[model samples]
Target chain A: MATLIRYALLLATTAVLQRLLLDQIRIADVAADGFLVLSVATGVVAGSRRGAVVGFAAGLALDLMVLTPFGLGALSSLVAGAVAGSLERLIVHSARTLTLAVGFASAFVGVLFFVLVGSLLGGVGLVDGHLPVILLLVPATTAVLVLPVRRLIRWAEAPSRALSPALR
Target chain B: MILLLLTAVTLLTLSGRGFGPLDSVRSAVGSVLAPVGDAASWATRPFSNAWDSAFSHDDLVAANQRLQEENDRLQGQVTQSAIATEQLQELLALVSIPFVGDTPVAHTRVVAGTAGNFGDTVELDKGSDAGIEVGMPVITGRGLIGRVRLVSASRSTVELVTGGGFKVGFLVIGTSAVGVAQGDGDPSRLRGANIDIAQPVTEGQIVVTAGLRGSSFPPNIPIGSIASVRSDDAARQSTVDIDLYASTRDLTYADVVLWKAAN
Candidate 1:
């Protein structure tokens, strides 16, 4: 389907950006998580299942460049995307403040979940003592990304679905 | 979503248990993306540099002033080197001992570093094809970087000293203080524990590699400087903190010591 191909391209593009470009752009030594933003954005517009799937694919692509357990990245992005996507049920607006709020919250919460899971799995180093910055940045980045991501999802998804009442 | 989570958890468990398939997946994925990552890294370098330069104007001014002072000092050293060159000929005749820290090395540019915030590894442009091997210490002009961890024909991964898995035998320079220093997941600092109780300690002292028996690093390679020293008399030891001199944020190139020569 066109949707699948579209998401596949997005996944690869974001992964490449995160792995190659954004990784080097550290603000205060903390690199912005590009995949996290896209994953949350996809979930916000495409609904939970698609969001989770896109996030997992993106996360797997990310795993190739990182040293975490094979699926750890997948898990983090999956939870974030899934939870954020599911929020579409509560709010009707797909491409506005509602989606941004969900995406921002998802990015922040998902990273917290990642750190918590990492700590439990003996990856305490993953926390890195920059909890405040990481937490703040994830959502801060999400805020910047929401509008662009919404437009991207609208272009990628079926026109009718994208143009539904909630999104308008 | 639940099923996906379960599947991901399963994969993590399997990888943690050392599953071969997972290794293959990781290797294959890494190999496939390494080039892409390399290209991307190479392409974005300008933006990264621009961002840093644009933001660090004051630091640049200070650094420029420092460089001016160093240039003046080096000119003096150049003058002294000519006179010292005459004495060195006589000293060389008297002593045939090898000089410390004169090892031959290969300088390579970093292609791709770890993408996220957590991992402290980097991909080098050179690899086994260039005679870079595992266990070789990587350094920059400033100080220690890390060591080669994984290698391929044309690319290799350097596990930075700040990585969670790295540990180094540490020594406080110009003093008898010795201890174990390991990364605390922060690139700017290392945690030093179990300093010898008898060795006197103080703030702002330099720290270097102890390079004890069986240690990978050569003796006395500068690592960082002591930021603080706190004593724990009950445990008969002191904890020291080291401030890393080499900034990982700006690390662009490193020299790999081939380790064939002791010096």
Candidate 2:
């Protein structure tokens, strides 16, 4: 219950920030996605299963806010989180390098999946010349945001850590 | 993971099929978040303006100078009162569409724009409570901008004219030619295809909405001006490119013209 409440607050806060501030801060006409960064960071902090669960919830929250097809954001975030969490096992102990690698690769895969799925569903404008710019920027932006978002997720999960028998 | 994926797929399928209950859920969520979004926007506006000023100071200065010159030119043109009044009415007729006469318009501020990379859309701060509904034409003083795509209790989304698959019926000024302009995923252009090769179209010719029976928009609403005309001999048709009059970027406020398509 505590975990659920913590994640809910985190998702709500991220969604608000995305709408107001992050959406306004555009670089080369493409804005950074705070939801994607948070999901990827959660994956880096937790494991693959927890990452997928959090990612899907986060995406669903995002879908409720945007005008896109209802499930697109959820699917993108879910896969991105899972991929990033799965990579956690193979990453070195250096926190900086791990977050950056996971953040970039996961966000890239997530956005690619979104475009491909959206195009197949008759989203004619989804795949355009500006795709290269989106591909370059979304992941790069996600990487820059990963470290801080991961720390926040870890802080939220601190209670769960304290209650775990192994930690005690 | 499998369970979650299945859930997402289910949601996509239900939403694509136009499930009505989902819209209620979306609206409910929007209602909950709208206030939070408004508060955040109010608090962060100063910082946002600062960021814009820091990056685009020179551009703003140039724009201010251009507006000053335009103001001076208009002031000089106002010479005699009676003549100016007649000309003012004529200018008003030219700028405002006749077919949109007395239609109740709901004015609202644009709260947000394009949430993701895929679509060209913006969100307005007023919704059904303000008499704004899906399919209503949104405009500024310049011309038509887009149509309302979705509406919640206090917010709505508009699909801009440049969004893919958007089509508007238009008539060429001073000619009998009519064509449908289609958006092809380009931000700054619309294409008019299958136009008769013999049509006398040229660069700089203005285009206005047809607003014929069953048309989406009202008649005489200026859409754009022709940028280029190409004759495709093999297809036996001419294609015309248009440059839109009302830009979609940086729109702060607009009016939702409350005329329905079927009406």
Most accurate candidate by DockQ: 2
lDDT of each: 0.77, 0.83
lDDT of 2: 0.83
TM-score of chain B of 1: 0.76
Tens-digit per-residue lDDT, A1-168, candidate 1:
667767788777787777766776667667778777777878887878887987887777766667777788888888888878887667854457676678778888778877788777776467666777878886777657766877787777865554355444
Chain A of candidate 1: what's the TM-score? 0.85
Best by lDDT: 2
The TM-score of candidate 2 is 0.88
Candidate 2 collision pairs: none
Two-chain DockQ for each candidate model: 0.51, 0.58
lDDT of 2 by residue, A32-127 (tens): 988888888888889778888888998898888776778988998999999889888678685787678778999999999988887776666777
Which 10 consecutive residues of model 1 chain B have the lowest summed lDDT? B92-101
lDDT of 1 by residue, B1-263 (tens): 77878888998888678676664555556667778876787687687678769998889899999999999999889879878856655664485523224667888998776768776888888877889877788888778878886666677788888877688888787787888888877878888998978898898998988776677877657789889889988999999888998877656788888773234
lDDT of 1 at A23: 73
DockQ of 2: 0.58
